[model samples]
Target chain A: MTAATARRDFPRAYGKVGSLHRERLWALRLSYTSLIVAAIIFLAPPVYMLMTSLKTNAEMADQTLSPWLVRSPTLEHYGATLENPLFLGFFANSAIVTLLVVSITMVISVLAAFALSRMRFWGSQTLATGVFLTYLVPDTLLFIPLYQIVGGLGLLNSIWGLVLVYPTLTVPFCTWIMIGYFASIPKELDEAALIDGASWPQMLLKIFIPVALPGIIAATIFAFTVSWAAFVYPTAFITRPEEMPLTIGVVSQLVRGDTFAWGQIMAGALLAALPPVVVYVFLMDYYIAGLTAGATKG
Target chain B: MSEVNLRKVVKLFEGGVQAVRGIDLEIADHEFCVLVGPSGCGKSTTLRMIAGLEEVSEGEIWIGGTMVNDIPPKDRDIAMVFQNYALYPHMTVFENMAFGLKLRHFPKDEIKRRVDRAASILSIGELLDRKPKALSGGQRQRVAMGRAIVRDPKVFLFDEPLSNLDAKLRVQMRTEIKKVHQAVKTTTIYVTHDQVEAMTLADRVVVMNHGVIEQVGPPNELYHHPATIFVAGFIGSPAMNFIPARLVNAAGALTIQLGQGLSVPVPADRTARYAPHASKKLLFGIRPEHLTETTRTDKQNLAPITVDLDVIEPMGMETLVHFRIEGTPVCARVDPAAGAQAGAPMRLAAHMDQMHLIDADTGRVL
Candidate 1:
């Protein structure tokens, strides 16, 4: 009401606004800095791979050539990797194995998750936990037994060997993720469906499967990435290049006796990693949501 | 329409939790029966048993004269509306309403006709194309009801379907549900914790508590003549005020003695009812509305009492006056214009004929 007090209040109000502005600026600066740092950390390996894939073989061999710079950018390595019958075979094998494993994982995991979560059978909870615990078992520990089993089945040098072993790694974790997603769904939806004349399988197909698409996508991504990048089982089971998945095929066939075809290897690795990366880029929200939904709900 | 009969049905959940214990109820065809109780009182479990959702652990459930103990819910010919509405989030309202009919392989035109008819009945016709996420809570509830209505099943089950809406919307939906039920004339079993909803919607109210059915009668019957103390306490808002008293026969008169020289005469009609328990401790149950400011015209069944007021809550039309009668707190719903004040002595009268005397030890109404 007085001029003197009004002037004092004006500066106090300005100070409050100034402090809020500074706080907002600090938050923005901190987020931007951390984002850039994270981007560099995550992008560095892929960027290096792309650069290596573009380098000429001569430049890669030159000792003075900077590893990060492709002085002579060439599509020669991509062309070579694509044209090589061995690389093409490995790529085809990986694609088939990944597709089969993903489909099998989704079907088995969806049904298992539905039963374990919704059906109130004896020991269902214990069985669900057991599935998750099976996933927690390290793959290295099971490789020897798995090897004997695969050999005993007389599929030692077959792509089917990898398919059989891949599910062992994919199904348990995928089922666990699905169980969490299914459990997070309100129980009433399934009950309502049941009252609406849906049998158990019908309920899963009509309601649970459609409602839990994000979790399914997340599980699919996990299954595909794991099946595509599988190394231990393929290396242990298949010594033949024809049956080796892309991961083992590339590493075994390209680097012969310590003479590394660095450009072609990087090119093959980059190409192999493309599917999952593209999947993640497009479905990042669903991936994170599914993962966190599993953790929190479970 | 078909009758739903539960013959001593019991639900023993895992770890020996008995949710519904021996509930024997027969809902006649086209009767609107409501199972009302407090939380954990097995009302919802009873409805679920009739719907074939929860397995009847120890008894037989008969719907339309057929024992349904071994039948799955899908074959039971009943439709249920869940408290959460349970509208499929991914489906449009039309899809949700048509799901049951499609499952039964009804003709597409028939399914459409049923859905449109039910949607119009619930006044949710325009929302048929919208997904459940795009609708409000009340709209979703209407869609849930529509989903059930389109089935034209033998029985309809509602598991506290209106519990999730706001107060105003809940009342509005309550009336809409009543209207829908009246129009369809299907045997319906509704469950809710709110007694008001039960009283308003049910032709017969089954009051349950502690896994047991305490009383089953018309809504007014349950309110006016509750069989147990729990029913009396559970079926009213602001609840019935219970005062510790003793029925004493002294000098050829029947009266209930309050503490510290306070007594109210029992009505002559109830004199013989209280005569046998003359010396026993009892609970005197009086609803708040029965206690009011003493007026000159009040003569029959109005026993005047004076007490020091503790608090006053004016609820628009009526003011709730809190007071202590011989160290026991009691509330009287008085005229708001009576200008009752806190900490002031107020003259009030308890309606003697409406008072309930319960055996203190067994909690059964006398």
Candidate 2:
């Protein structure tokens, strides 16, 4: 039966107000209002960033023009930022570090999750909980100790230092997400594969990986975003402009002793944010599916 | 050659819960055997041990004369269909059927031929290109069976595969599975809690309860001659009624005395057998169909009883009337035209020819 007929048969659930419950509509209106307010509050900064990136330096400094509006917009700041080789070098460094970090994190996390969830030994349960607990630790507190390890390796002023320390930020949470996905797969599927004549590695590659693709995509997006935008590790280790990622590179290079080039800084920041935004736009469905995997039956 | 033998098989889970306690069974080649019982009765556990999914804790499992206790599931040459129809969500139905062959490195053309043949057997040819998520529940069940049939393994195992389908679809698939097994002629072992499915599909039904086998025989034999009270009650629908009574020697004829001073004489042929238990308190077991309206004739063992009908249910072809025998509830399946009604006295003919005398202390039928 349709829900409308069900509501008619069970009318007390709709209350004495009939099919259109006034109290329900009021609750719905309040929820939508709060959702709209939350959306605007979260979106204001990006919208303002785009406006500033389009504005000319003269328009930005003018006392009469509103900072929110870009009157007589120019692409001069964008063109100048692209032409600067120092800016391009920082972008390349961030891209390479993110690529390496994400790959390393996925390898470690998938193997760790498969072992922790399926291959049981002593203390396996405790180890799985401990992996998630590490993700809860704030990275701000970790960067100080990680600096010593990176410095002890004699790699203080290098981009490799960020690559070395970034997995500590990404692996714990990615493994935690992967463990949830792996555990949710019914035990029968693996048994069915085993009966179908698949070895353990074959089952992992052909069955588990394809079945858990959404979780892997979600973890990849997380690792990419976290490594690309990471600031504490790079700032603590690398002082050279060429060794810096986009997060520390743009801020330290653009602002000089309170002489802030607001327009160029905004343009450079927007350019650096393009990759992750594109990733989210293309894979938003899978990301949401992965996050809500254990909350409901698929 | 493909017969299966379980010699004293046992499965003891951690912390001392014995799921299957040293049960022995022999399934002949190409015979459809169903292990049926209530939940947690070790029926599914027995099927899993044969499939090599569960380790045999204490005994030998021989399949095709090969003593497969050490063999892995892949090397054991068996295919299983799970209850949920564990089709890979990402692969098409054709690919799902071809997975076992692909894993074992069969040639591409050979895999395609086998998949096509199995699809035709299940009539799922049109659905071969669709993923499992796109199919209905019945369609998924068909694909799961198709996956098993494509392998041409020595034996087929099904673990309550039809429990997920609706009633109508389950019956349809039941006929489909029997047809497939007949065409393929593979030894098969099926597990289910449904007695009707067991009776309809199996060549021999194996009834299990609490980690042990209760009885194993053909369906007709089990219904006509159950060895114990559990089998007598578990086999038939509306179930067999067990009324408490006493066996007495009444002037050289053995008669059973029920609680309401109603006495039923044993048939003359059973006099020698029941005379030994003449003074023992026993349970008189009679099926509902055997206790009907007082209209049946030509039976020398017919005995009459008057009962006040407490509830009468007209079920189109047959009417089920519930009555009491000295405070013990008894059901009778009479013809719908027998004029049975509630709060009225009715006369029922008890077929003493089919009556069973049981030792109440031991639950064994005599």
Interface RMSD for each predicted structure = 0.6, 0.5
Candidate closest to the true structure, highest DockQ: 2
Q: Write the per-residue lDDT of candidate 2 for residues A59-175, one digit (tens) a residue.
A: 888999887888898998899889988789999999999999999999999989988987778999999999999989998999888888999998898989888989998999999
Worst lDDT run of 10 residues, candidate 1 chain B, spans B290-299
lDDT of 1 by residue, A15-108 (tens): 5545667888899999999999999999999999999899887887888878888777999989989998999999999999999999999999
Pairs in steric clash, model 1: none
* TM-score of each predicted structure versus truth: 0.94, 0.95
lDDT of each prediction vs. the true structure?
Answer: 0.90, 0.92
What does the lDDT read for residue B26 in candidate 2? 97
DockQ-derived CAPRI band for the predicted complex in model 2: high
The DockQ-based CAPRI class assigned to model 1 is: high
The runs of at least 3 residues in candidate 1 whose Cα sits more than 4 Å from the true structure, single-residue gaps closed, are A1-21, A255-258, A296-298, B296-299
Q: What share of the true interface contacts does candidate 2 keep?
A: 0.92
Clashing residue pairs, backbone N/CA/C < 3 A, model 2: none
